[model samples]
Target: MQLKNKKVLVTGAEGFIGSHLVERLVELGAEVTAFTLYNSFNSWGWLDTLDEKYKKHMEVFTGDARDENSVRKAVEDKDIVFHLAALIAIPYSYYAPASYVDTNVKGTLNVLQACRDFMIEKMIHTSTSEVYGTAKYVPIDEEHPLQGQSPYSASKIAADMMAESYYRSFKTPVAIMRPFNTYGPRQSARAVIPTIISQILSGAKEIQLGSLLPTRDFNYVKDTVEGFIQVAENDKTIGTIMNIGTGKEISIGHLTEKIIGLIGRDVKISCQEERLRPEKSEVNRLCACNKKVSEITNWKPKYTLDEGLKETIDWIEKNIHYFKSDIYNV
Candidate 1:
């Protein structure tokens, strides 16, 4: 399907992946509506960081996703929807599991319901590798058994099932686009990439981190964004779940060493207790099965881990002031 001149709605347009997605949609000449979580400051989150020209092209809709009226209004008259809004921090999810349920599960219900009602052409529902938990097997595929090791993953699992149900029960056009460990500029401190980058950017001699043994399949944010668009553009992906990832795994310990090398840091690594997840909750390893996505859509990761990390480091170096390196984010 062609994307140019189409009207698209991107929920979570103020977030790291969402913001880049909005910019990409704009570049592709799509008429974009940006759905951002409303705040007292009237801030648009990372979308506020975008240049005026690109930001001007977006119709910013400030609303809570859990509110059906707000979400329904945003869905009205949109040809396609990219549902990316969620409460994504796993540690924070442990504190407020109900919030994750309300936003991730209930909010996704709203999106699916709206699409069913309006018969939207495409709905790309975002999923995460976390739902697979610790990989029981290498290259976890779409058929891999989902293990909700945390509240965040549980909520996402609920959301994903909701999307699938709509397709099976009501024939809603939906694509489950699961991304594995996306990292890039504008990412929040709650994520490992930014946490390490922030500390290095702050010139800390001691780098605090959690369990460094967990492994992940990392995808560059730009590649992640492109994968989303490509999935949406293909009719063959409807009612299917696909993973976006580079089929490569890196341990956190090794990742930290790489970061230290890239940042030229001689810092001593310190394992902070608060930074660690429960052993049962930690995903010990994850390497994605990207064959499903490649078979249906022209989606592929375009950056090597080192290349992506270098770009992320450069961004953090310049935006060091935006981070609170003195405290643990979550």
Candidate 2:
């Protein structure tokens, strides 16, 4: 299960985490294919900014993951597939739930079918902490009940179930990698970390945010990517779901204050009504139990919250122009 000289296909490779994964895979000596959403601009999303040294080794295939034909073409001849393509914005999902189902659930089905047909060695399916909703208990484990509070989480739950069924029915070498809140460079402004950092760096005295009471277990992007690699290399991970996260939790209000302190800025926190999720849809708390991943693989979170926030702040400061802090990004 060594990745060296192996062929790997990463769907959504143009995204925040996917681009980083592609870079790491190249560094690991794997032949990489990046499946990006097609556009007339021919944009590779964040991958377009990757250094040539890493980008040169990656083959970019621009296609929609929702299309079975496109997914099959990308899966062909690949030893492993990392499925990450999806519509992830929670607010946007509320407005367009069908799109989320089409992209998240159906898109995943396309990839799973392609992997099954191609007989790929491994397919790492991405899951989210949102599926757990508001935790019924502290330090949620893989077996914790999945409550889809929002359309986005519901779609992901369906996708995860699809992967599980494929593994059981067809013996597809599928491993579900559930990552908690992952934050770092190239993350969209829709996410809380980027939203906070972008606003502060944009010279806003007031930060607009959703619920401040919700607690989340945040993991740095590098740590999450390593978790993916660890799952792929371990044959024992097949047909299992593993959680990747720092076992620590932070409230959004505390996280905002920490970011402000790191940037050495004084800011006012404003909870905008528009930014808030519906009462039932909002996941109030999430804490990961990394016991499964730690006991089974070498994956462990390396960066503390302060450390990761500092890095994210630095990146957002330098790329401040990329964000429109005045507008709430859906």
Candidate 3:
């Protein structure tokens, strides 16, 4: 299960976490293929920002993951496949639930089928903390009941189940990696961390946010990527779902204040109705129990919340031009 000299295909390799994983895989000496959403402009999303040295060890394949043919082509001849491609924005999912199903669920089906056909060694399917919805208990474990409160969470639930079924029915080597709130460089402004950092960096005296009460277990991008690799390299992880997180929780309001302190700014918080999720759809709290991943792999979060936020703030400050801080990014 060693990754060295192995062939790995990462769907959504152009994304924040995916790009970082690709860089890590290259560093591990794995032959990497980056499956990005197709675009006329040939943009590789955040992958374009990777150093050319890392890009030399990787192949970029532009294709829609929902397309079975495209997915098959990308999965072909690969030893392992990490399925990360999906429509992940929760707010956008409310506006277009059908698109979320098509991209998240069906896109995952395409990957699963291709893996079954190709007989891939391992398939690391990405899941989210959103599927757990509001925690019924503190420090939620893998045994926690799943409650899909949003269209995005529902779609991901479907995708995770589909991956599990593949492992059971077809004996596909699949490991579901559910990461709790990962944040770092190249993360979209739609995510809370980026939203807060971008706004503060943009010199906003007032920060617009939704619910401040909801608590989340945030993991740094590098740690999450390592979790993915560790899960994939461990044969014991097959047919199991593992949670990757810091196992610490933070309320959005408190998290905002921390970011403001890091930026050394005095800002007032404004509750924006448009940014709020529907009452039932909002997940009130999430805290991860990393017992499964810790037992299965040599993976644990290295960066503390303050440490990660500092890195994110530094990156956002230098890349403020990429964000429209005044607008609420859906």
Candidate 4:
């Protein structure tokens, strides 16, 4: 269970959480392989910006997760595999549901099959709170009904089910790690936190957003990554699904005000029609019941919302040029 010198492959290593996980794995002395989406620019996404010292401990693989051959090659000889690759933008999913099915469902099936064939010691498949849709009750647990209100959430539900099937039929050592509204530096502008921060940093006095009443359990990226490591290291987590969250909820409107206050900005928030989801498609509320993870492993969110937002704002302030605040990202 010790990660030191253990070979770990993280699919979607170019992404926000994946890049942070890759960096943490290297720091833990794990032999890391970063699986990134192939691009002509040979871009490693966020990995391209990692400190030079950490790069020595990492291997970068450029390939599509939808390709079985590539996933098989990446899974080979790995002690653990963290599957995080998927099309995660909710608005974009409405435009191209088929792409979500292909990348999220099909891509996850490829990863699970590869792990099963390779007999990898462990596989951590990523899940999201969006799969639960609008929570029917406060502090939604693992047993909550999954209502796919968006194509993105539906694709994730299918992927999660696929992982479960692999465990039942093929005995793949797979565990699902469902995180609730993860945010931090390196996150895409499609996410609300980044969208708000990018706009504020761009000197926008009026912030455009969707529904402001929807509540969410927001966890910092570092806490979510630690949850992955905790789940992978714990043998009891096999064939299990664990929620990684802070057990707290905040409305989007309040969250926006919090961010604005942190940034010391006077901003007016407006609901944008272009950013709103369909009536039934919108998840109005979500709050995680992280009891399973807390009891099964030593994982808990370490950052408060204020602390995390401060860090995110600081990072975005310095990297303002990377964001096109004037253009709606989705």
Candidate 1: 10-residue stretch with minimal lDDT: 293-302
Please report, in order, the local distance difference test score of every candidate based on alpha carbons.
Answer: 0.93, 0.94, 0.94, 0.93
Clashes of each: 0, 0, 0, 0
lDDT of 2 by residue, 221-276 (tens): 99999999999999999999999988899999999998888888898999999999
Q: What TM-score against the true fold does each predicted structure earn?
A: 0.99, 0.99, 0.99, 0.99
Q: What C-alpha root-mean-square deviation, in Å, does candidate 2 show against the real structure?
A: 0.6
In candidate 2, what residue range of length 10 has the lowest lDDT sum? Answer: 305-314
Give a tens-digit lDDT track for model 3, residues 235-297.
Answer: 999999999988899999999999888889898998999999999999999999999899889
Off by over 4 Å in 1: none
Colliding residue pairs in candidate 3:
none
Model 3 regions more than 4 Å off? none
Q: Which stretches of candidate 4 lie over 4 Å from their true place?
A: none
Clashes of 1: 0
The residue ranges of model 2 lying beyond 4 angstroms of the native Cα positions read none
**Candidate 1 TM-score, C-alpha based:** 0.99
lDDT assessment of candidate 2: 0.94
After TM-score superposition, the amount by which residue 145's alpha carbon in candidate 1 deviates from its true location, in angstroms, is 0.4
Per-residue lDDT of candidate 4, residues 32-63 (tens digit)? 99999998998899999999998988999999
Error of 3 at 96 (Å): 0.4
